[model samples]
Target chain A: MLLSVEDFGIEFHDHDSPERVVEGVSFTLDKGEILGIVGESGSGKSMTALAIAGLLPRKKLKKEGRILFEGEDVLTMERHKLRGLQGDEICMIFQEPMTALNPTMKIGLQVEEALRIHHTEMNDAQRKERAIKWLKNVELDDPERVYESYPHQLSGGMRQRVMIAAAMVGNPQLLIADEATTALDVTVQAQIIKLLQKINKESQVAILFISHDLSLIRQISHNVLVMQNGHLVEKGAVDDIFEHPQQEYTRKLISAIPRVEL
Target chain B: MKKWLKKHKNFNFIAGAIITGVLLLTVLIGIFATPYDTTQMNVADKFAKPSFAHWMGCDNYGRDILSRVMEGMGNTFLIAVLTVLIGTVFGVIIGALCGYFGGLLDDILMRINDVLFSFPSILLALVIISLLGTGRLNVTLALGIAFIPSFARIVRSEVKKQCSLDYVKSAALMGAGHMRIIFVHILPNIMPVLLSSVMIGFNNAVLAEAGLSYLGIGVQPPAASLGRMLSEAQSFLFTAPWYAIFPGLVIVLTVLGFALLAEGTTEEE
Candidate 1:
């Protein structure tokens, strides 16, 4: 398995109550596969991804269970070891690309920073070259100009593309995209999905695509995981879940998708 | 530079630039040239009024007021700069550690900061000065220590704000260590706020140092400071009001310059 998360749970501490935010979430991602996690806003989907990346807020949060990447337990790993795994072997792309990027940083320099941190063997010139190459790979028009521009200078769609380039530049084995396309227009969303697909095909990287839109998940994901109120309601191949959802929650989710008559 | 000036079309900002520029230029000029030896005493010229020969008159000791003011400007500016450097360097390290890690360490550090903050800053500086012994170095150290809590508070809050931002979390997930995240990512973003704080700190430092010196515990005799000059002129106020006027005016100008500069920068954000 490329990545396996077993019995993962998260609890957030409140003044009077300890609320279990994510419970018994488990899944396996194979190389070059796209796994879609579908849920509404409070479904604990994002928290699960944060736990895998080890980016959960330390205070008032308690995590349980194991996340294994390449058969190594992520929860028990040393902080330094976990850090080494992040951005090198595993990377993430966030939902709001406009705010996800550092506003003051140039697009090229940001991409170069990813390479510089992970691929220390590459010299400055080589890093810059690689960053520009990644920007081109994302199919941005006038890559050089875009590279020179700051995050605020770019349009929403352009910034999202730059974010993708930065995330993928390290060639991570698995990329967790947490609602990566929710902020974009439908046309731009399609382009980003296509770009992500191309990167997955070309690099043989696994993707954990999280989104609330069932139709978008159905179109892009090979395997689907349904979550509701912090519980994993269902998990199976995309066609099986869409055609014959066993769980009532999963059936309700599938039926909730907006459709158009031909 | 002209374009930047035009973009920031605030009267206080322009006035601050002019005043602060003049004060800094006086320090630079004092380094290379002063009209008379600041410490040289001339009994015949004592308490002379402002003129070409003895501009801004002479002090009770007959030391040229203009030269002494210039020398005091240099001393005051150095102390303020040094105090700010010490405060900012130590404050940023403490604040970054507390804000970035933010658990038991934050609580402990902030409690310490709170204790420091509760005491009136001048009293804290006075206590430190008494223990460390009164001198230029001791006053600077005392003032620097006194300045730390405010800087730490500002930096801690700013760092906390930056930490909540998506970019910082993204940087951490990108394998950047805590030190790298705080310094490389968050520091630059919080700088505009920090810069304004530093300007305010400079203003406060100048005032505090003057207060310390006026109390007879700052820079010793022969080394001119605005506060020391004011102290020496207090007895001669009725006999020679000009003795206290020059240094007093300069002190007011310096404080006003930095205050306006701080206000301007804060508004820019």
Candidate 2:
């Protein structure tokens, strides 16, 4: 297994009574597997992603389970070790492409930054080449033009592609895409999903895809985990969950997606 | 360039730019060349009217008013620049730390900041001057320290707002350390805000330096300063009104230049 969570739970120690965000959420992701986490608003799906990546705030937070990446507990690991895993081993792409980029930095430099942070031995020229290569890999038509442009200069879909390029350039073992395509329109959304699928097949990097859309999840993910109110409601292969949902919550969620009937 | 300026649609900016540009020329010219030596006193020519020979007339000491005004402006401008430098460096550091990691560190730092901020800047500066002793360096140091809370407050607010943005989270996920995220990610985004604040700070610094000198605790004599010229001209106001009038006019113009420039630049936000 590339990643594993054993009885993993998260609670915010914000008030007199600690409020639990995620509880008893246990799952495993194998190498090159695409695991889709589906949920509604206030569901703990995004929180679980943050916990696995160690991106949660360091203050007034409580964790009550083991998150083992390569058999080493992520919760118990040193900060430096965790950082080493973050960008180099496991990368994340967020939802808002417009705000996810540094507005002042050129797209090329920002993409190059991923490689620059992990590989100290690589020269600027080498980093630049890799960045452009990844940008092209994401199928941006004019990699050179997009590379030189600022974040604000590009459209939302283009910026999302640049973001993906930056995430992929680092050659991470796991890519956690948290609502990565939700901001785009349907056409752009389909294009991004296609790009993510292609990257997964070529690179064999495990993907933890978090999204609220069941249809989008079904399109790309191999396996699925349904969440409701900070708890994992169900977990199975995509076909099994759609055709034979065992839990009422899972059935309700699957049925919520409107279908066209002849 | 023309297109960008027209997009701003701020007349205050253009007027401020023209005045500031002219003043900058005068200050630069003052460094290398002035109409007459600032210290060249002509008791016979004292209280002379504004004319081709003495465009701003002469003081009671018979010193050329125009030369003194030029030299004094340079001194005042330099002090303001140095004060702002000190404020920006220290204030940005404090603000970034408070902003990026805001649990206990924010509470502690901001409370101290509030205490410092509560004092009227001029009063705080005066207290500092009383302890540090009177000189250009000392006065600049005092004003700069006084200015820190304001810069820190603005930067802190900006950073706090930015930290909530997804880009900061993205940077963290990229294994960027605190320094990288604060300086590279957040600071660059807040430059427009910081730049305008710096401009306003410059305006305040110029006036504060003049205020200090007027009270006889800043920019010592034998060295020309706008404040010192005004103070000296007060006794001879009736004898040579131009002495006080010219220096006072320069001070107002200097302050207004920055105020207008700040308004212009602030509109970009």
Candidate 3:
């Protein structure tokens, strides 16, 4: 197994109450396979992703569980060790591309920065070369021009592509995409999905695709894990879950996909 | 580079040019030009009116007023620059750390800032000067300390907001150390605001220095400062008005240049 979680639980400490978010959640992601985590906004899908990456807000959170990445316990690691594991071993793509990037920073410099930080051995020339290469890997046209442009100057789709390029430049083993395509228009969404699919195929990197849209997840994911109120409702192969869901919530979620006339 | 330059406004460029020219002129005058040694006194030339020999006229001590004002401009720039440097660096470090790290650290640092803020800056500066004893160094320390709260408050809020940004979170995920996230990702992004803040703070530094001098605790006599010049000119305002006028004009020009530059930078942002 590439990544595995066992008996993981997260809770928020309020003044008078401790609200549990994810409880006893367990799953595994294998190499080159896309694990689709399907849930609504508050279903704890995003929180789980944050826990895997150690990006969850710590002050209010009471996290208890074992998050094993490549056989090491992530939750138990020191801050420095956890940081070392985050971007190099596991990378994440956020939902909103517009806000994901710093507006003042040049798109190319942002991508290059990821490389410079994680892979310190690489020189500036190598980082720039890798940035340009990754930009084109996402099929962005005029990568040179786009690199020089600031985040605000780019369109939503282009910014998302730039984000993807930044995430992929580290060549992380596990890619966690959190509502990655939710902000784009339908057509642009399709294009970004296609781009992600291409990257998955070319790189053979394990991906954890989190989103609410079951149909969109079905398009790219090999296995599906449905979450509801911090609980894992169902887990099976993508086709198996679609055809033979064992839970009511899973069936209802799958059925809720809007039907379109041809 | 040319395209970016082309986008620059006429007023910003003009104002920046004027400020740069004045700073350079002051520096040059300090380094080289002076008809008479600023400290040398000629009793015979006392109360001499504006003429080819002594363009501005003589002070009460028969020292050259024109040379004194030029020297004062240089000293003013030095004090302002030093004070701002100390305030901005120390303040940014304290504020960024407090804002980035919340809980007890944030509460403690911010409460201290609040206490500092409660006292008016000038009054606090006065209190500090009185304690440290009157001198150029004391005045600079008082003014720099007085300005620290403003810098701290501005940087604290900027850091708090920036720490929540996706890029910062992303950097954290990218194995960036906390220092890296604070200095690299967050600091660079907030630099434009910080730059503007520093410029405005420098303007306040200049004004505060002047005010302290006007109150008689600033740069002492024998050392040329626009404020000291003005303080000495108060007695002869009716007759040798040029003593006040020359230094007063230099102060206005210096202040105007900085004000215009600051306004332009704020607009650009």
Model 3 ranges with Cα > 4 A deviation:
B1-9
Better of 1 and 2 by lDDT: 2
- Top-TM-score structure, candidate number: 2
Q: What fnat does each of the candidate structures reach?
A: 0.64, 0.71, 0.75
Candidate 3: give the clashing pairs.
none
lDDT of 2 by residue, B7-83 (tens): 77889989999999999999999999999998877888878888999999988877888998999999999999999
Ranking by lDDT: 2, 1, 3
- Please give, for residues A160-227, the per-residue lDDT of candidate 3 as tens digits: 99988988898989999999999889999999999988999999999999999888999999999999
* Most lDDT-accurate candidate: 2
- DockQ for candidate 1, please give it: 0.77
**Per-prediction TM-score:** 0.96, 0.97, 0.94
Q: Which whole-number lDDT from 0 to 100 does residue B154 have in model 2?
A: 94
Off by over 4 Å in 2: B1-10
In order, the Cα lDDT scores of the candidates are 0.90, 0.91, 0.86
lDDT over C-alpha atoms for residue B207 of model 1: 93
lDDT of 1 by residue, B160-259 (tens): 9888778888899899988888898889888898898899899899999999999999988889999999999999999999888989999999999889
